[model samples]
Target: MDIEKTFALLNETEPLKISTSREITVAVMGAGSRGNEYPEYGKLFPGTLRVVAVSDILKSRREAMAEKWSIPADRVFGDYREMLEAGRGGKLADILLIALPDDLHYEPAMEAMRQGYDILLEKPMAQSEKECRDLARRQRETGVMVAVGHVLRYSPYFRALKKAIDSGLVGELVNIQHQEPVMYAHMAHSFVRGNWHDGKATTPMIVAKSCHDLDILKWLAGRRCVRVSAEGGIALFRADKAPAGAPERCTDGCPHEKDCPYSAIDIYERKRWFLYVFDLKRDCPAEEILERLRTTDYGRCAYRMDNDQPDHIVVTLLFEGGVTASFSLDAFTPWGGRRTRVMGTEGYIEGDGKTFTLHRFRTGEAREWSYAPPEGGNYRDSGHAGGDLALIRDFLRAVDTRDFSLLSSSIEASVESHVMGFACERSRLSGTKEDV
Candidate 1:
C-alpha cells in the first residue's frame, strides 16, 4: 500500500464503507474511565457494537463493566494478562479497547493483534517512538485495523474546520497557532498528584496528554512535520510553591485549604468534578470524601508532589508545506478549550472550541460555524465534545466493513504525530531543535 498516497487522499471526501448488520463484540482492558466510556458506544449505536468482556485489576471496575454490559461472569478477568491468555489461541472478541495506562498499551495490544483482534488503542498509543512504529508495522503485517484514540479529529467542530481548509475556503495554509488549556483542577488532579505525576514512571506528560493536541495540529497541517523545537518545565506546581501552612495532604487540617485554588476538597468534594478517578460516589458524604482523599493520591498537596510535568509548554513545528505552527499546553488557565487561528494566503480562520469563523480574503464574506450539543441530548455524558462517540462510530464501521480508510486517525496517521511529540520532548530537554 502507498501510505503517502493514502494520507494525501485524507483531505478529499471520504468514500463509502461496507455495512454490517450484526453487532461487533468488544472486550475492554483496564476498565478505567476511558474503558468504561467506550462501551457507551453500544448505547449510542444499538446493535452496532457490544461489550462482551472486560479486564481490570480493580474488582469494582471489572464488576461494573460486567454488570453494565450483561457480560457473563466468566468473561470478567481480574487481569488483562488473563484476558490476553484467553485470546491467544483464538479471537475472544472482534475488537479490543486497550485503554490501559501509558506503560501497558504495547504488550497487551501486540498480544491481542497476534491473536487476530482489531483494536481501538487509546491515544499516546505506545510509550516511545519505536513502540508506535511497531504497532503500525504489526497492523500492516496482520492486515487488521488499529485506530488510535485521536478523538479530536472526529469532532464536528474540528471536522468542519478540516473540511473548510480542504475546500480551499482557507487557501494555501502558512501559519497556525493552537492552545490547549489544561485547567487548574485538571492539571493538579491528573498531573501534579495523580498517576501521571512522575514523567519517568509512566511517560512524559507531553506524550501523555498533549499528544492529542499534536495529532490535531498534524491533521490540520495536512503534511509531515519536518522540524520541531520546544521549551517547558515544571513552573508553578513545585515544592517551593507550597504555602507555609499547606500540609502534605489537603485534609490534614491545612489552614490555607480554603484559599488555595487547587485544594483537593474544593475541587473534588465541593465542585464535584473529576470524581470518576476515585472510587467514591458523587453523593458520598463530605466526610467520607475527605477521608478517601487522605489515602488516595488526590489528597497530596499539588505543590509538594514529585511531579515532572510542566505547568506550561510551547512547541514549534515546521510542516512540509512551510506551514509553521506553534502549540501551547497551558495549565494555568481558568477555562479549558482549544483556541486556534489558521492563516492562509487567501483566507483565515479562528475558533474558540465551540464556534469557528472562516474569513475569505478574496470574498468579503465571513462565515461562522458553531456546535452546541443540546443540554439534555443523549451525548451529555459523552466526552471530547462528542469526539469520543464519533471516533467509536468510525472505528466500528472501519472494522466491520474491513475498510481502513473509513477512519480518520488510523495508526498510520497517528504515528506521525507521536513522532513529533517525542521529538518535541527531546528538544525541550536538550535545549535544541530536533528533526521529526
Candidate 2:
C-alpha cells in the first residue's frame, strides 16, 4: 500500500489543528500501562496524536489513567465496543490506538478499519496467524491509513546497526545469534504465571512476545526464512518449584515470604513490583493489589497456578540464500533485555542489548556504539529503544502523503515474520524442522 496516500488522507481530513497547543483530542481505545504509557512516544506529537478518550475493560484502570492524564470522565468508557460504535458514528475518535490484550486486537481493529479511521495497532497484529492474515487482507482491500507498532524498525539504535551491517562494515552476512532473555520475573508476571497465563487465554509466547524478533530478524537478513526448528518446554516456574512450607495461595497462611525468590507477595505486592509494572505516574496501592489477589486468578500462588507455557525456548532459522540464524529466549534470566551477534564472511557484529560492537576484516579493528535511552526507559520503551516516536512520525507522514517507502514493514514484510514464527511454533511442537 502507498503510505503517502494514507498520510495525505489523514492530514487532509484531520489537518492537525493543534487546538490546545499541547494536545490532540484523540480517543485512545486502550492505553493503560501497556500501550498508552509508551515513553518513547512523546505524550502528544507536539500538537497532534492526543488522547481525548480512553477505553478499557477495567473501569478503575481506565478511570485512574483518565484522571492521571486529565482525560474528561465522560470521555472514558469501560467498553471498547462502545468506543468503536461511537467512532463509527463519528462521535468516538480521530485516530484509534489498539493497545488492548493480544487476543482482543481483532474486533476493535476490524471495527476501526470499517469506520475508515487511521490506526496504530500494537504488534503480533492479532492472536492467531489467520487473524493476522485477515487483517493484512483487510488493510489491502480498504486502503485505510494504518501502521503496525513494530518499534524496532523505528529504533535509532537498531536502525544504525542495520545501517552499519548494510554499509559493509560487517561484510556478507554469515550467521546471527540473537538471545532475547524473556526474564523469569517478566515471564512469570506477564505470561506463565500472570494475566496472560495460557496460549488460549493470551497467545503463544513466540508470537505474543517474540514477533518483534521475528520481524527484525527478517528485516536484518533481507531474506525470507525457509525453515525453522524449535525446542522448548515449561522448564521453570512450575509446581515442582514450590518452596518448602509454602502455602498453595498467597492469601493462605504460610512461611517463605522472606526467602522465596518467587513469592507472590514479594513479586507483586511489594514496591519492587512496580519495576515490572513500569508505572511512574502512579504507585499501585498495596491494599488494592491485595484485594485483587484475594479475588482474581492473577493473585494465585505462582507454583500452584494452572500455568502451562514454556519458560524457555530456542529457535533456529535458515533464511533463503543459506543464511543461518539462531534465537534463544531464556525466561529465567536474572537481568532483562536482548543480546545479539551477527557473523558475516568479512566481519562480525555483537550487541549486548544496548551497545553494538562491529568488527571488519578490511580494517582489522572493532568499534562500538552505545545508545543509552532516557531514564524510566521501561514504561516508555518503544521503537526498539526509543524508536517508536520516529516510527509514528514516519507512518503519519506516509499516510498523509501516499508514499509507500515511508513504511519499514509493509504488509508483505510483516506477514513474512508472522509466517516464519508460525512455522517455528509448528516445528517446536512437531520436533522437526518445518518449512516457513
* Candidate 2 residue 250 C-alpha distance from true site, Å: 3.3
Which parts of model 1 have CA positions greater than 4 angstroms off? 1-19, 372-381
lDDT of 2 by residue, 1-436 (tens): 2323322232121111112333334567676654564422436434545567789877767886687668877778888887876676674654577888777888788778888766778776777778788888887777776777787776756775676666656668888899888766677778856657787677777877788898888888888888889999887667787777667677676576676666666777773464334332236567767665677665567777788777788999999999999998888888876788989887888986667877767767676666543333331244356555656666556655667677886665777787777787788888988987
lDDT assessment of candidate 2? 0.70
lDDT of 1 by residue, 291-380 (tens): 778888898888888888988999999999688999999999998989999998888889987678877786676767665453324342
TM for every model, in the order presented, reads 0.93, 0.85
Q: Which candidate is the best by lDDT?
A: 1
How big is the positional error of residue 295 in model 1, measured in Å on the Cα after superposition? 0.8
Residue 167, candidate 2: Cα error in Å is 1.0
lDDT of 1 at 234: 86
How far residue 63's Cα lies from its native spot in candidate 1, in Å, is 0.6
Give per-residue lDDT, candidate 1, residue 285: 79
Worst 10 contiguous positions by lDDT, candidate 1: 10-19
Given candidate 2, what's the lDDT at residue 223? 84
Tell me the spans in candidate 2 whose CA falls farther than 4 Å from its real position.
1-25, 38-45, 64-75, 275-291, 372-384
| Model 1 clashing residue pairs (backbone) | none
